[model samples]
Target: MIEENSLHPETLAITSGRPRNTPDGSINSTISLSSTFHAGGVVGYGRYGNETWTDLESAIAALEGGPTLAFSSGMAAISAVFSILPVGAVVTASNQGYSGVMTLLHTLQASGKIEVRSVDVSNSDEVLAVLPGTALLWLESPTNPTLAIADLPRLISAAKDAGCGVAVDNTFATPLGQKPLVMGADIVVHSVTKYLAGHSDVILGSVTTKDPALFSRLEDARKIGGAIPGPFEAWLALRGIRTFPIRFEKAQANALEIASRLSRHPKVDQVFYSGLASDKFHERASSFMAGFGAVLSFTLHSGVAEAEKVCESSKIITHATSLGGVESLWERRRKWSGESQLVSETLIRLSLGCENVEDLWSDIEQALGNA
Candidate 1:
């Protein structure tokens, strides 16, 4: 057997979780596509385990450096993390992050299930102040929409010292750009619906952990909550992982170029990309991350109306929700009512894709002009 650590992640992305020396000469694992097995082995039912989900999970675990479990959606994986906490547990999370996560946290708080502490994750001191009684410290670096970077090492260390579990949403950074587990996070979650799949075609989520107890707990949560992914979707995501490295390379390159150009554009007030030296979080992000991520956000001088117009006017970039597709996508952040008020109403979030940089920029220029 090949040692996972001895191989590069790019090579692992293509080669991990594959069947070894099959007599049928098949390279890819086929979808099991059954609800029940023959009742003779460890996995008796599809919901408990499937070779397809296992293959996808194994590939992600290879990148994340841990055991992983796939969920029906990113939110499902997040919910499983919360499930680990005891009733009435105190949870601290980013004040501004993925709206779905924020919404779920607030909903739980409203139901008197968990006490919520919202803090600026970029500020270590602010985060630490509320950690004493917290059960979990949830972090999202290059945070959703606004792209604020966090000091993961400092926060994770403090959380551990305080006896709090640490969970990081690595959806934005992806496993390739950053590894929170290596930084000592207890758990890492991803909305595989985004970058890992590399196309907008599938919806999936994952939870990874180096701790066997935590992994077993989360695996039970997955099985009990019935948050398993479809066999076909898992197969599609595994197919997508084969090209994850190359796709991310092209996307990040386009992001750097587009963010630079957008920063210089007259109509743009500010660009929020950690890749740009002018960005506030650039230094922090560069200190730990392998690369600045592919997503960037910018605010328009003309406000929300113009932001909406820019999204609508784009020809090449799709005006849509969800990201990390082969084609570029952009959206007005505050259009969703649940979105954090901390995010500027005029902010337009861009998900850079593997499209030609010049073409993407031309689309942006035309959109800005029309707006």
Candidate 2:
């Protein structure tokens, strides 16, 4: 068995996936560019089950502390999970879940293959009310754009008792900060496009689970759906993952300071950050997250119009979509999310990067000035 020794994520980022390949034992793991290999019977036919891909899978599985599978994108992983639901199965989810996911559910419901109901994920009562008939409890704590956190442990307990499988979008928190599987969730999904890759170059997704049944179902969906990542992309994601600990730490430090400063800004109306003491998500995050995380949402003093101004006026901050890279990103949430309550007309989403905290804040403070 190939084993890796890692104590901290920073350590893991450097040490993980590195095998002793040289006769004298080299320190780094080599990237295998091979597209196919022998199964000890015949030549491998395609990208499916390639050596490099399998090595990437093994590294990810080891890091997540569960059996993990890679996919083409975060949406692919999510869609693979939805593929498991039987016809007419019901999924109770946060109304604020990712818009793409909500759209996927709606599409399924429209096709008569599934039923999806949206509700406030933070309200235990709201979620529990539908648990009995729910086939899946789709959850996103500190939900997209709104930064609303659900009572994860409570929901997991209730969902299990009701015979509903639970899946948590752990992207916002990243595994560096949160482990939903360890906290009783059946499946943990991530848009590796965000924090996991740490770079914007690769779009990937992952699902980690202890349940073999759930793993088998998702694995089948992955193989049959033909959404597997290329060996090189997987290699890139694995490489990016090694630096996750350090990148995550720096970004989070910047985020906490940014959130603190934003709350006090005269031009800011609302700031949503789990790290904020005043935030609704604070207590839950304090208890559940290893770190408060880097993503945040806030409203400008002037709402939508001001939001557009902030996006365009900033020189250092780029008004763009997407998060979890080495550079700062800013986006008007409402415009991108199509009016879901998760993203308000006045809201701006910021994904803090590895840049100097002082610099990022200076840009934000200045941008908010004219807004």
For 166-203, candidate 1 gives per-residue lDDT tens digits of 99999999988899999899999999999899889998
- Which window of ten consecutive residues has the lowest lDDT sum in model 2? 41-50
lDDT of 2 by residue, 1-371 (tens): 53453355566566656664678875645566665565674436543555555655666666666888888899999999998889999999888778888888888999998998899998999889889889999999768878888889889988988888999998888877777887788999888888878888988888889999889888878878988887778778878887888888999999999999999988888999989999987988898778888888888768678899998888777789888987888888778644486466888888888998888877887887877
Q: Cα miss at 306, model 2 (Å)?
A: 1.5
**Best candidate according to TM-score:** 1
Candidate 1: worst-modelled 10 consecutive residues by lDDT: 17-26
TM-score: model 1 vs. ground truth: 0.98
